[model samples]
Target: MKHGLLWIARALGLFALCSWLTRRELRILCYHGIWDGPGHYGNYLFMSPGKFRSRLAFLQDWGARVLPLPVALERLAQGRLPARAVVITIDDGWASTVAHMVPALEQAGFPATLYVTSYYAHNQRPVLNVALAYALSRWAAGERDSTLLPLPGLGQLNCPAGDAIALHRATDQVIEHASTLADDDARQAFLCSVISATGLAQDPVWGGPAFRLASRDQLREASAKGIDLQLHTHRHRTTCNGTSCLAQELADNRSWLTGVGEGPFEHFCYPSGQYQASDWEVLRRQGIESATTTEIGLCRRGENPYALPRILDGESLSELELEAELSGFLTMLRRISRR
Candidate 1:
């Protein structure tokens, strides 16, 4: 019902008018990995390649000007942004990014910034937490055995089969233990045992690129192909653990990115759109030029650089809904509702 009203608004050319009014506001688009494999693995985190291509098509059809992130921010601050200026940013450097997203961007002749978290990149392993969660989520509710599975070196798990919360708790327990493993090999072995216990060892997602981060070689190749590589932190975390921990994250992030031969590495995206008030000073201390959040809005001059907003494009968004975002219709509605 609400979608019908949105379509009506678009047909009435209200989106066009709103877009014109917000022309000076910078529109930042945030994306994650592209997933083309089987089953529903959540839309926002890993969008389908076809949907992403269609989104790029929509941007072209809307006559939006795509700009590099750093250049767009510079122009925005100087009050020199073009009409419908948009910046594309991909977070986490998923392995699928190099395989799927980069080619699409290349074909479109659009430049994008990839904010990579180096932990997985350096380790060259499927992230333990994500892998376990996905494995748990894919198990049929009915097939979940209520019996506790015993794991050596980590004690027994009494995960209630069909309960999402219980599965999540079990995943956390495994993750906590896996984190203590001495190396990726040990961790991989541990993961295999858990998957075997869950009776999902044959699931194709494990063998596929679904849970992997881009390899170091692929990252270098991506940068060489005109993808601007940037920082998303070393460990993909934001902490209340103090400025020093945060600073080390950036240092480690930059340390890995240096191998990519791209730099100044000043721009950052908060992991999972998470940040705090005190983070501003932490970012400032690190010489971060601009930082983007998952907040949905258009960027304007004089807003906090550390908390700049972005529209998160996902698989579930219809073409019309995306048009509303790119055309600034949604932003206008949000403002009006706040009044």
Candidate 2:
């Protein structure tokens, strides 16, 4: 009942705000994986493909102008986009995108930007989303009991139910410890250590099917279908750790993308959108034309290209809700500014 009331209040607020938008702003919607089956709660990480298709259809029927990322950027630069212009972007080249989103995009005739991690492309490794889901599921199932485990930099991560805050703190420590690893082997070793220490490896779900990344063939197919393949770092490293490491990640991704014929890749989505000012400089030095962050807002003319904002889409939004949300983007921005 509380959740329903909150939704009702938000809808009323959105309606009021939409009545006052300037009528020229554009909203860029960002998405990640599209799943097909029952999903876990708190896993806003993936949206079912059917729901995604319905949302796209709603946008199309409502006269929303769907533009590619490059075209939208060009329009924003020249101040020439239609009043309802919107750009659709998908981050993390998940296999589900190839299996599900591609057909819907092709049928709808919508062009999109896909940001991929070159390491995952080359190694076919599991991504952070998959790992997070695995870890959370294991914790919930009581398969992982308390154990002492040594992290690389931070000491240990303990597993204990009803200690969510402590668990998150330990998880952060483990993440930081693993971030310093030079290669996938080292990183995986660190992750395994964490799993063993937290006693999470005992969970049946951990032994079950792990999510898969997109294959080279899938990426090539997407490229052939006019989806712009862009850089998302080599290993999806968070930038808050160190600028030098972030710079190396950007450089490595640029080289890898070019070598794999995924270029001329000009746009970059920060690995996890956790960047600092120096990180932007590193991207600039790497010759990135534009970069996207998880921040939510509409792009305006003269706005900084290096730190542009994006609205993340997940499972929570229904077709009608998504339409209303997209329609209210400019209105929300204006309302926030007035306050």
Provide the overall lDDT of each model, using Cα atoms, as 2-decimal numbers: 0.87, 0.70
The regions of model 1 sitting more than 4 angstroms off are 140-186, 240-244
Tens-digit lDDT track of model 2 for 1-339: 645653665677764456236245667788887665334433355777777888788778878788888888888888887877888888878787877888889999998888888777778765544574456445544544445445455655464666667667656655555656797787777666656655666645344323566887877888888788898888788553433587777777777766444578889898777777877777777788898988877777887888888767777755545655566744475568989
Whole-structure CA lDDT of model 1? 0.87
Q: Write down the TM-score of every candidate.
A: 0.91, 0.79
Residue 260: error of model 2 in Å?
A: 4.3
On the 0 to 100 scale, the lDDT of residue 15 in model 2 is 43
Residue 132, model 1: lDDT of 74
